[model samples]
Target: MLIFLQERRLPLSLCGWQMRNRLIYLPISSITEWFAIPMVNLRVISLAAPFVLCTSLFALSLVQAQSLPTKKKSDISAPAPQAKTVSLSNIPHAVATAFCETYPNAALVSATWVERNAETCIKLHTSEGTKTRDLLYRLSGELIEMAETISPIALPEAVKETIHEEFSRAEILSAKRLVSAAPTLYEVTLSFGAEKETLIYDAKGVLVRKVEHLPRAVQKAFEAQYPRAEILAFSKQDEDGFVRWVIESREGQSHREIVYAETGEVVAISERLFPIDLPEAIKETLAESFSGSTLITAKRLTQVQYHISVSDSSGNTMLALDATGKLLDMDAQSEHVLLSLATSPAPSQDLKAEEDAIAPIPVALPDPEVDLAVALKPIKVEEPLAAIAAEKKERPVIIVRRYYAPSLGWIPPIMRLWRPSWWW
Candidate 1:
């Protein structure tokens, strides 16, 4: 047991009970005599004692180890790297040189060191005129990626041509360029009437992505409502968490804009109108209340109301009227105007046409048969009445016939009933 204990290098406390009883070092004969046990049983107990003590010690140690606190794998892991701001002068020579060479006109705003794809990189913010640019570069002075805000006029000819070809009437709102991209790219925002769209294109002017489309429900509703309307542009918008679709269309010379809800219900509509297109009631109302007022602009909303801007001697004023030509909201002045309009009778169509008609001018007919001698001949009162009557009957009477002109209604003919001695 002792030899086994020494080889195992177990502590003496493992067999403390045996030591307290003074049985650990006792001989087998003494053990048997003291306990009055048989020699064979004593030998067996002595050999098994160390084994049992060692087993108990191992079990106790394992239980104690399990009860203690230990660190978790996540707690010992390394932290992630974060970006750190740095000054331009602190940047490496290669990085600074490359940036200056690439953007000589750019003014630096900020610089930072960031980890990208497990490699250190430098990020730069720069400005040129009103535009701003962001660039990412490697420590080896190689450009990784760059994005720059630009004006619409700075776009390449190819890109401009592509946009014009696709949307001839579209107005560009903003433009952005991305350098060092896989194929380079440009992002453009355009406005068509009240609608807006964003289009992405490659450097070669090829369209890469377009994200403007109406919902199926909205498309169906608009098509059903305005089957003959030529759609110029359409866009989707989210207002205060509510989604809507806006469309601009044209029907002949008139333009219209419409808004629709996600469920395909119309929210609002505005249609542009010419002065000549105003309703008869509206024209009469304007003539009576705002005479001599030149119309600046006119629009009808949902066919329920008319909003018109007019300019007169007093300056411009906007008026809102209903379909029946009644003011929507009337003040004291407006009430007076309305009362005057109500009291006065509108001119009839025929009267207005006659007042606008142009006056006719009569022209004289030429006579080619009368000779100079006959024209110069004088009438003699002493000559016989029958001879004078015969001479007058032989002469050609100047009868001017007037005809109706398409533009002018009719012209009266002039009759030459009397002639001077020199005019035959």
Candidate 2:
């Protein structure tokens, strides 16, 4: 056995396995050579070899498992919470009771359930009088926040006094109140003549901050386009989740309103135009198409379209035209006004001129003395009475013309004496 062990190069110091610092290379032939020893020794080596091999494999697997990468607790993410729309009836009793107690006059517009952190919350949209409100509350009846729209008149007396004292000439446009803040907060939008701004205030009506101003980008863009324009009004509006800025301004005598995106991009423009400001083509079209009509209002929309309102003997008309003076549409308040004037009854002739041209000639009154002399001397008859009568019957009689003159009032009829042919 010792010779075989020596040939196989097996270390005789197996009892010092724990103290061995270097790796030991065990070949398959070394184990096979164990069978060459006595049968009793072979059995003992076989059993021990299998056990040691299994133990080594198990230890290798454990080391590999420990060396593998593991994710930190912070790196793991929880699923996002979702909000669900629900009816007022479906809301928790506690939440509803809390909302009613807080906003007794508010009418529910909508209610929704949302999961936040691990707790369930309720959101409500409500309206009170002319004001609209949004509220959030936890399931346990704890109020989270409340935002409400309010009019200028609804501002607290302290806030109103502050604004009046600070900005005496400013007109309040809108007011909003946030109840979530520790001291509560008020946001007030005001206009000082043409300029507008938003201001924030605390519950005590102390001015906190100014929240709005003409953005630098917008100011640069506007100045580049209208260098000499005076800003009339500046306001911000939100439409469909997009923010827009509106600027009303005037350059010389021209008034214009421009809409701009948040990025200072011009979206649209509206310009107020006087009749004299219109293009030559437009003026000519208006003169030819709507003769004798009064131009009420004219506006240029986006430099492309023109809107004009005109009034005439027939009725009022609204005209939509393009920049080239081409009429796109025309709407008349009265349908008869739309008809061509040529189809109407012909205008009456001037009767006053005709009457002046053929005015009745005034007959000269004979002298009273000459009439007396004629009456005294006319006794001679040219023929028998029957001949004179027959001659008078053959003569034509003259008829007098009469007319009414409003300016001259009524005129008396003119009388004339008839001279017989026999007397002549």
Candidate 3:
């Protein structure tokens, strides 16, 4: 039987047997001489052929898979490393100078190095009130553009009305006042149901553009990073040939601003600040220097600067400070104005003083002894003509009454003195 099977020309129907619990047939043509077959009966070879062929195929597949070159984990491509943080030394001199010149008092919150149009550049993040400013600069430090993130309240009345008129029922998510390129405009984010819409309006509130969706990569990356963050505002910009997506989101008390490339790489990130997080040093300095002063607000202006609003006994005033909590120089007129305001008396206090000063003073009381004596002075009475005629007097008669007199003797009203009767 073995010799006959090795020939590869045996009758096709001669090999048949039960495999497992079922009958199986093995064609003679399928049996190769190279395959080792046990010296078993014809029925056994047929039964095992299918099993052996399957086993051999699986083993071959495994060997082939193992033989293929394996890729190292490090060989897998990943996104290019983005800038982490930046310092003054890493910034180009021209950029630093130009920035300082443009915004002498602007407080820098952060700086990042990014690639734009195949060239490296700097992105400076600053803050002023609820506004977060992003400035772009060339490698040579030349100013490219500046954009600010503004709150809904900062939107112009016209723009707000336009939004209201258009999306009357849509909830306004956020708004931004952009001051870049030509014609400053406003970017308003409105949400209706689960859909978010971004509308751009010019200074006059005229609709300039609308963005309903972002590039696939940018959206995917953003959603993956911040799945639960409520998107406040979104904007897109084209610098040279590179595109950037600016996204602002709020989660609970935290706020975040992210700039993304069209390729889904995060270029920069800035945490939006609130007044309650004013530096302790700033609060301490204000407390020690301006006692009884209350901090109204403290905003991050730059990486090393802050704009603080405070209310002292006088009034509310805004001042700037450096990173170390040192007071920064403000405009001469503004400094004088704020100082004067700080030193000047409050209107409420001034009014109170005026009221007290205008109050009438009480007149000095007269002497009670002199007043009583004057009131109790005696009175004199002249006799009438009829009484004088009745008395038959030849000369006019005078009568005097006194409350008290040493010269007059004490007498009851019903009795008259003998001397008084004679005088009468």
Return the top candidate by lDDT. 1
| Deviation from native of the Cα of residue 37 in model 2, angstroms | 99
Model 3, residue pairs in steric clash: 95-141, 107-301, 107-302, 108-302, 108-303, 109-302, 109-303
Evaluate residue 244 in candidate 3 and report its C-alpha lDDT on the 0 to 100 scale.
71
lDDT tens readout by residue for model 1, 207-274:
98886677888889888988998675577767556676778776655667787777777776877677
TM-score of each: 0.27, 0.27, 0.32
TM-score of 1: 0.27
> Between the candidate structures 2 and 3, which one is better when assessed by lDDT?
2
lDDT of candidate 1 at residue 319, scale 0 to 100: 84
Task: Please write out the lDDT profile of model 3 over residues 4-122, one tens digit for every residue.
Answer: 32223333333362234333444544554334453345455566677799899999999999999999865664334433334556456788888778877666656655445666566
lDDT of 2 by residue, 14-45 (tens): 42443233455665465556445554575566
Name the runs in model 3 displaced over 4 angstroms. Answer: 1-86, 114-120, 215-424
Residue 137 displacement in candidate 2 (angstroms): 1.2
Ranked candidates (lDDT, high to low): 1, 2, 3
Predicted structure 2: lDDT:
0.71
